[model samples]
Target: MRAVETGKKPVLSAEIFVIPIEADRFLVYAPLRRAAFVGNAGAVNFLADLREGRGDSGAGHDGEMIEFLRRLEIVDAGPETPPLAVFSDDPNPVSVTLFLTTACNLRCAYCYAAAGEGAARHMPPELARRGVDFVVGNALARGEDHFEINFHGGGEPTRNWPTLTKTLAHARRLADAHELRLTAYLATNAVLSAKRLDWVVANLHGASVSCDGPPEVHDANRVTPGGKGSSASVIRTLRRFDAEDFPYGIRMTVTADAIPRLADSVEYLCANFRPGQIQAEPAYPIGRGAGAASAETAAFVAAFREAQGRARRHGRELTFSGARVGTLTNHFCAATQDLFALTPDGSVSSCYEVFEESSPRAKIFLYGASAGAGGGWRFDREKLAFLRRQSVDRRAHCAGCFARWSCGGDCYHKALTVHDDGEFAGTDRCDIIRELTRDQILARIADSGGVFWHEPPERIAAEGCACVSCGDEGRIMTGRGVKKPDRGCV
Candidate 1:
């Protein structure tokens, strides 16, 4: 250890890395010593002193050790900002997954859209036109130069070919009219014929097909309404696309039934059909799978994690769509701001899981239907305001969390699902998030030659503001006596 003198104190100096295990737990590794601290005080003090330009002293000071120091300037932890809110005015809505048709060719055991009922109606051409117009107009109004539109379904979007074709044509017209750059995509079961595949290639920017794992795992849950397995057909479709070198992704919905063979599922997909991306979404207990037990859910999570770990080592990227990434550090869920889900009926929502009718937090604005004439669109500004206000309440559990701003309280749906109320705070999910975040930070530090701060690039860039969409722009306009668009009014 190199010894450095700081005002007569001999500070032991060497490069070190630290990852937070949780609010009270952390993994600290230095050339001289490796230990885990149970609280923030020691780490906080050490970080503070280092930020103030104090070099590490060879002598390890309790709660203030200069143990390992580096020549690099520490990354500053900027003020907290809410998640998802950060992109309120993102130049363009990066992606849109439209429920083109609710009709389905198969009946998955865990379908979230409840596809079998007459509720599985094809979006009328007029409604589809309105929906496309709403999204495109909203993007242009916000000054976004580029956008992506994704066509999806409650059952199968391709089932209603005529309607879908019309919608695509309408979307194209809107994009062309505005001269906005756009990418088109589709998420389907691929039960359609080769002709449909050709159409997709010609019109879509990309496609995503559903697969559980292997034939056994996939067939166990994804079966036709007549009880026939659809796995063989799905694989056939994928093989065709793979042979054509079609660009696509795989969407795997992890359920309790599929957990036991999670690794097999991932391996099967990776080995057989190389996809651009793999997304693992946990089953939500609604629609077709509402009766699924919690034990099965837990099993699925374990299996999914195991499979994901292996796949990652093999150079595959697996995204945990439903998992909370920043829970330990902050209380704001990224879905609340980062992305907005526009329902087929023109309801703008925050998270896909929460229905607009059930949760006020989900409603951003309702378009197409008349507002007060029993059918017009209505922008629920009050509901949106309530959600924004509640996001920063700072509960008891959040008082000591160091990554509070970064985590943004995990997923709001997880909170509501696990606790039965959106207003409730804290969960076991936070513990998992803290551990993961700490590990990621430590890993980055080590990769950067050790001795690193815990803050991430996004966290360092964040600046607390009253509105995520407008940020400082709103204040500037207000000072200039210009009327700004009301929050949630878009």
Candidate 2:
């Protein structure tokens, strides 16, 4: 409620985050108002006095600093950022993400789902048909005219080839029959046979393929059933994709072992291949990677920064899920946004990591199930409501964070793991998120003529010449990029 006064003492209004760059210089930020600038310690103390109700009203040096802040809207502006909107009604999602199977062709060391470890479970074609029917029906009823079907990985989606191909054919027929537009994307490890690669190129709209850079780095982790490197197959897939001019993105996972090579990997990918987007994330300990040394460290952040610079040189962006700045949102990804992802058995999961019925966190994420043959779906309203409530605004730990709106509270799935299903506490990813987001902010300022930066359209935030490679179609990025299923998951 504080504001600048004509004769009375001036007051600080917006919440400020002072990030130091030098002994005296700092990045003064007002997140809600979307204002920022670099200032000296004297400028900092001037604001501090105002915050403490002792701001010098005398028209002198402190007065000039006050005027500067006022111009930035940091002296009198109210919080323009609103609370995250929550959906209370029954969920009627237009997008359907199908976790096609749990039968990956390759064994990734940091595989979050630990696919190929289990006996393998393939989604029934009937379940796919039913999901397609439901979504198509919803689209028609809602007058959407278009709907999306995304194939994501609980395992390699392509491993369930018969069902994978057949489902898309069925969806196409439905699209044709109703004269409705249908779009589909897949997430894969990219170790493909010629026929499968050809099928993917021909049938699907796009894909997010997993590739951890050079043969040595990629092969060190991503191997096959008989302990052979899968990099050759992956490279062949990329080559074919390049030849076909296929629309796809490359997802690179940096393990502790891969951290040193991150910049090199990004350099290699940018030099050798042509991918529209390249996203890299530190390997979190989960699945086969559980208890493995975490790549989520300061070293990874330094490496990502270097890799981002390399990617920019190639006219491509290098990104991480949890460090997007310039984005404004409440939830990190689709998990909180009613992402209707179907598990292999036709069960529903909001999170990609919690794919099976037996997953420890199933009760929290598995909110619905197939109501059987003729019946459609049965969702737990309570669970859906709980999920919707997981936005950044409700998170206390994020309340004071300047990057909260941009990072969108990181990843809920990861948060749960870190907090052991208890109250939300910040994670190690917080440091990484803040550092990268800071780099992005500085880059944005530098890009928009560096003295200062306020707000711009999301496209401007996400695109433009910023060195940060953390934008997702102009949407918010957070731990895991907490986004739609079209992006690759490993």
Candidate 3:
């Protein structure tokens, strides 16, 4: 609160936060001001000396630095603005993820929900109808022209085909009545009946299949409840999807053992399935995988690079969850945006992994239910207050991170497992998020000449990424014009 210039000798800006990229270059970002500045080593030194009261403002070099920063409006102090309101008053969305049932055909080793092969619970028709009504009503109130519904859950949604179909039918009716465009998505194990497969292919806007990779790799961990390999059925499902021109992608959960085979797995998947996209995510130590350690960071990065290269050679795009370029966000996913995920029992859960009210984390994640008067759904503002507190601005540790907004301090559920408090401490994947984010940003700038998502790419230093480890490498563009380099790290 002291005057920014205590002695009026061109004091360093109170808003600027510098991240050194090299001895002569730095990435200066102001979280409060929402700005990023690239500085040369001279500017960095000048700023450091100024802050320490050793800089000579009379020097031409120092004068130029001050003038440049003054032009940026950080040199002069501004009136104190209140903390950024990252949380919205209306935490409502025009989307819903319907958990058709808590049952699955396969028991993957890393299954976060331990779905299926357990106490199976199917969502009642009444609850499903109410869930749809809740989201549709919000859409209507917001005057949205379209809304989305994703059929997904801890267990295989297709397993409860009756409830799934009924819910979709009810949602479709509501959409028609409201004259809203209904965009539906599906996430399935793909080990389903021919009728279900056909319905999904013909219905969904897009679908994500839970497939590890080749049979050997996939079956090793993703197995049937009765100790049988589920690869054959899933492979058949993928083949059917491909044959029918169904727009779908494969999602792989990378564990410690799967890390070594990642590249080979990508190659095999590309050779066999030719999926539209391959999303690979390292297993988080949650649910059934709680006891298992995640793959080594260096190992995962190396394997990801190799697999990415293999995927590129086959005209496929390899990606990881929350690793996309040109996307600047303060939350990792849509959970904070009021996207509802209805449990089989009709409990509204913010975190997909924390579905059961019996869960210890339920108090923080479970925010609503279909217990409103006349069977409508009701949201709990008190529980939602905890969720609202998780915005990026609330995490002090993430203030200096370049990926602070992109990753949003990682997953809330996972962050809770590691931290004993409400304030986000992030998960063990902090390093990975930072490195991957930096790599993606540099790769995008290299390909498009800037990071236009947050601002024009020209705002970044044009000389190229100053990271010495990555050096100057050619940025490869995918079919979608998204740039993801197969090599390099921050």
- Top candidate on TM-score is 2
**What TM-score would you give candidate 1 relative to the actual structure?**
0.71
Off by over 4 Å in 3: 1-40, 47-59, 62-91, 322-325, 421-424, 448-454, 457-490
User: In candidate 2, what residue range of length 10 has the lowest lDDT sum?
Assistant: 465-474
Off by over 4 Å in 2: 1-13, 53-64, 457-490
- Tens-digit lDDT string for candidate 1 (126-230): 655554565676667667765555565555778878867887887787778889776666768877787887888778766777787788889888888898888
TM-score of every model versus the real structure: 0.71, 0.90, 0.80
Q: Model 3: clashing residue pairs?
A: 24-41, 104-116, 450-457, 451-457
lDDT of each: 0.53, 0.77, 0.65
lDDT tens readout by residue for model 2, 339-394: 67889987888887877887778999999998887768999999999988888889
Residue 489 alpha-carbon offset, candidate 3, angstroms: 23
Q: Least accurate stretch of 10 residues (summed lDDT) in model 1?
A: 471-480
Angstrom error of the Cα, residue 264, model 2: value is: 0.7
Which window of 10 residues has the lowest lDDT sum in candidate 3?
A: 467-476
Report RMSD for candidate 3.
8.1
lDDT of 3 by residue, 235-346 (tens): 8888888898877777788898899999999999998886777778788766677789677377898899899889989998887654543344455543443546788877
Q: Ranking under TM-score, best-scoring first?
A: 2, 3, 1
